[model samples]
Target: MAALPTVQAPGIVNLSYAFTNEGNLLYREDSLNYQKEVFAYDELNRLTGWDIYDDSSIPNEEHSIV
Candidate 1:
């Protein structure tokens, strides 16, 4: 797969990645270098849950997407 593109960073990711083994996205960091979001997948390599940075400003609080 192609590498994640570098954007002008519209309050979003400047750098990001996907795990090669499962091809699952790991995380995305903003230009400020703070982890903006994170991800997790199931045994079937399907996306299970993720964390969102809200007004609380917390990081990686487990929450299911489905």
Candidate 2:
């Protein structure tokens, strides 16, 4: 019998999520790509804005929802 080579599986995703006490998504991050997403809500728990950060880039992208 011959030994075979071992290979790592592809398409593996390393994601993390966070939520508020009210069960609203607050943050999400991808550890593999060093990307992060932050969410903001208003007093009524409505989405107001969000920001996405890429560690590979100099400027972070931010978006405001109306």
Find the candidate with the highest lDDT and give its number: 2
Clashing pairs in 2: none
lDDT of 2: 0.75
Against the reference, the lDDT scores of all candidates come to 0.64, 0.75
Per-residue lDDT, model 2, residue 58, is 46
lDDT tens per residue, model 2, 1-66:
222222233457677777787767788877777788889999999999988988754439988999
Candidate 1 lDDT, 4-52, residue by residue in tens: 6445556654664555466677765555565556788878888888886
Worst ten-residue run, lDDT, model 2?
1-10
**Every model's Cα RMSD, please?**
4.2, 11.2
Off by over 4 Å in 1: 5-13, 33-35, 53-62
- What candidate 2 gets wrong by more than 4 Å, as runs, is 1-11, 56-59
